[model samples]
Target: MSVAFIDSHMVEKFVENSQAFDKCIEERFNMLDMNQDGVLSRDELQNDANDSSFVELALQSKEEVDSLYDVLFEKFDTEKKGGLNRNEFGLLMKEVMLAKAHGFGETPVCVIFQEDSLLRRVV
Candidate 1:
């Protein structure tokens, strides 16, 4: 019923192995490749429909998805220049997978950036 519980259950159902997980990552990479240039940009990531699919899987709504993106774009904008590099995007994906494994429900995967940071502070 909780995000964590949903995340764990989904991971169990969908991410049974490393290959499966890699496939998910690859799918995400392809989605984020908005320009088809084989690279990802902050605008592409922020506006990606593929990114939305993960949130939809996690069962979040459009407004929630938007808010989540706002937070991720803010944090991953490491240079405060307003965008994420591939490395930052990869880190975000890693955290999402970890959260899924840990059974965290999805407000949105992007929300994980803020939630994880806050959770770490609390812990």
Candidate 2:
């Protein structure tokens, strides 16, 4: 992991550059597609999702965590299908990044992001 200073402005600039943002999203989606298939199954997403200390820190209890995941999965599965296609994954990622950016608004935070992490790539 590497420490980086990040804030809303920097993230907003990255998102505003559509070409770069799309490229980054594509890269991240590909990485998350664990079975080498173009579609991402709920299981695939949950595999990586299990390690989110950030979410655990914010939520008060296990029930909250489970409920949040359920809600998120339902939201991401826009087609009502069991899996997320590239476009759906892209949309979900864009929203997630933007939300993160909004949370960091005007406040620079020191974060330790994994080398291959999306946040690290964004920075």
lDDT against the true structure, each candidate: 0.55, 0.80
Clashing pairs in 2: none
lDDT top scorer: 2
Query: CA shift at 44, candidate 2, in angstroms?
Result: 0.3
- 1-123 per-residue lDDT for model 1 (tens digits): 113213344554454455655555666677668777655665686565444344562576768767887888777757665656556666676676566557555432322332322122211
Q: Assess every candidate by TM-score.
A: 0.47, 0.83
lDDT for residue 81 in candidate 1, whole number 0-100: 58
TM-score of 2: 0.83
Please give the range of 10 consecutive residues that has the lowest summed lDDT in model 2: 51-60
Q: Can you write out model 2's per-residue Cα lDDT over 6-83, one digit (the tens) per residue?
A: 998888888888899889888878888989888898778767666663555355576776676678769888877778
Clash-forming residue pairs, model 1 = 3-104, 3-105, 4-103, 4-104, 4-105, 8-103
